[model samples]
Target: MADHVRTVLGPVAPDALGRTSIHEHLLTLLDHVAYTPVETPEGRELGEQPVSLATRWYVRQQWVGVRDNLRLDSEAVATAEVARFRAAGGGAIADPTTDGIARDPAALARISRATGVHVVMGAGYYVHRSHPEWLEAASEEEIAERIVRDLQEGAAGTPVRAGFIGEVGCSWPMTDRERKSLRAAGRAQRATGAPLMVHPGRHPDAPAEIVRELDAVGADLSRTTIAHTERTLPSPAAIVELARTGVRPSIDCFGLETAYYPLAPFVRMPNDGGRLAIVEALLDAGLGERTLIAQDICQKHRLTAYGGHGYDHLIRDIPVMLEAAGRGDAVEQLLVANPAAWLAW
Candidate 1:
């Protein structure tokens, strides 16, 4: 079959996917780790506190601990939120909420239908911690079969088939099962001829290590992407090094400007200017075609419904920033052409 972008609605032409976000979560539950006890003030249960203006500061600081800030369960809310993206001329979204992260393929389909935005769902396991206990006993072949099924058939018992093979989660000091998951993703990609994306651990070496893991399985590096490069690959040099492997490095943390990353305090997230600087570095290296970017709006606080920049932030805001930096011509390549080429398997 010719290369086409598989969407929840069905197969679409590559050029049809205009202004796409390569990584996002339309609906998910992080309660697997969010509700865990954290250091709170004097026996106060901060994890259970609902999201509000009063609690937004704490939620921003310790988002993983706040229950309300971690969940995106409302279909109505997702539809409304995505409507903003449609209004801003967004044509597609790749929601890579795979296994271990409460992926609702049915809900994604509904949101796509309501908003008229093409949504490409992901298939595979997430981080080792978010992984199910049954995964420990599962072999790579078994995992690969499941992923293949999701791509060719349907996901989560729904008729909505996954269009891609990841945001496959890997942690720093990759667990045995996580390594197995990467191998499984590689096999699944080989089987289905689908594009793959990976959520690398929060370490500098994590992206390169994952490159080795996938390469060992004979997967197509050019068809694979290393997601969250903004947080994983610290320096522009590190980002360039990973891109040399023929794997697209996705800097998918656009609107998240806080320097203190709650999950990894040691890692200082760059502001928008810093993100553009990295973009310049990639362009300078003649790797702009190999680069991808998104907002990666997984947290509830990152949604416009909750005082956060909606899906439109990238399309609506960033073009002007690029223009100010005298790189306005690259916007089409980054937001439309690159993603369309990558997503079209």
Candidate 2:
């Protein structure tokens, strides 16, 4: 039998995954990894304020520290947002919410059922800091076994099986546990024939270092993605270099336009225009097939309910921009074909 794209609901044909957002988080509780230090008066002020019209602008600027902005846990809000995405022509979403962060398989199933969009849940741990304390002592085999179980059976005690083996977390100066997680992700992908996604560290060198780790485990590099390429790699040339390694380079944070990245202050996050430019550059480099894009909307501030672009930014605005640049043909490739190919098992 042909391989299928496993989703929260069940198996879907790869081609059935329509204009897909390659990376997203319908529900997230990243405050554990992103809460602001309430030491100074300014810090305390930002920490306490809820995400609102008055706070949204500043929250966008200083996204990481604000506790309210880091969370995106509303199932009702997610359904509404995803419904808008479907109305705007989105057909599927790849949500790599795994361990560490809050991965709600039950909520994802409900969202998919409500909106009729394919929801691809991820399996594996996140950053070392967000990982469950007991995970530190788990062997690589144990980790891979859990990932495989999530893929083959059900995730988080629900019947929603994971479609992929990542957004596997790796940080700059990678920890031993993170390395073990990468190897386990590789093993899971090998066992189940699912694609692997990775959230690389802030360092520019992180993507390549991660590729080395995955490569060591004999993972299918072509089926692996080094996500957050726009933030993690310095320039289009650097991203192209990583793409040459046979792993897809995903510019997953499309709607986020901020110079001040609170997570990695030194690294400059690209605006939408700059992100499109990177996409064009990838197309120019003949690496279009290896490119993936999404909003990676994990924050409350980025949701339309909170006055941000919501899930349809890629579908609503990006094609117009790409067409204006004379790469009109690239729109379908970016939003539909590329993701479909990458998402397939």
Candidate 3:
């Protein structure tokens, strides 16, 4: 009578989803979209130094460059990462790397098998910059059909189909093609009842714009997640307003404490404590059921293999923080039940 949560290991009852991390990237090529934080509303100068110098010194090393942000292809590494999550009592992970960003469904299936953790792959296009050569020429119907096929059939010739439509990347001022892709993703979500997780550009207001556009196309906001709100929607009130609209405001990006814009002229990254505070605020606002969290581990630097905080951050760190903040029950709803319900039909 109830919908199952489709995973790489096959569909399972929603209760079967234990502690779930609603967003992540187990594998990906760094070519999806070039994020220019300086161009964002949050961007600011590092100091008196010119932005060009800060851009050249820091941004180039951190976020840009294909080699630095190259594809994380080691199954052994992914296995180790997933193992940490599992050991920390993690139940499942949703990998939202779509077409443009280098999605490997078969490999994801292999990782799921290797680690025995449920994996959900994302379908649909990323930002227009890294889109396939034919995406611009393709009709919205054609794009939607491709994504639907990926969700229902298989992605990249693998029998393993995607369980979700996105972490569909969109910029602040949405592009024409980006809007088209969002609409197509909405069409696929309507067809599959799978959630659409979006990566709104690094601005607090970006989520509202994205929701407005997605709503215009008749998307089920309850089935949509506006991601990276830890950085985008700075205040709990801002996030609560978005969640009140019926869409989930995902407070992903845990343990990534490095100020993304290390220097002036780039948007900054908040620490984990700040994120926990926001979580407390959301719970206080009584929107705990409408929110979720994840690591958004996209780079080697974010992985344990590279001496970073692995998948255990949220599972290990947050519960203490949550209970200390007095919302212990909120953790279960955010990481487990909310993800299952959002991903299920």
The C-alpha TM-scores of every prediction are 0.97, 0.98, 0.88
Number of clashes in model 3? Answer: 6
Kindly report which residue stretches of model 1 are placed more than 4 angstroms away from their true locations once superposed.
34-38, 42-44
lDDT of 3: 0.78
Off by over 4 Å in 2: none
Candidate No. with top TM-score = 2
Model 3: per-residue lDDT, tens digit, 43-71? Answer: 43332122243233443344443234445
**How close to the true structure is residue 17 of candidate 2, measured as C-alpha lDDT?**
84
- What ranges in model 3 sit over 4 Å off? 35-66, 262-266
- lDDT of candidate 1 over 1-345, digit per residue (tens): 789999998999999988989988899887775454467662158778787887777777677778778888889989998999999999999999887888888778888999999999999988987887888999999999999999988987888899998889898889899999999999898777799999898899898899888888888999999998988877888888889889999988998877878788888889888899998899989999999999888788888878888889999999999999999999999999999999998
Cα lDDT, all candidates: 0.88, 0.89, 0.78
Clashes of each: 0, 0, 6
RMSD (Å) per prediction? 1.4, 1.1, 5.3
Give the 10-residue window scoring lowest on summed lDDT in candidate 2: 34-43
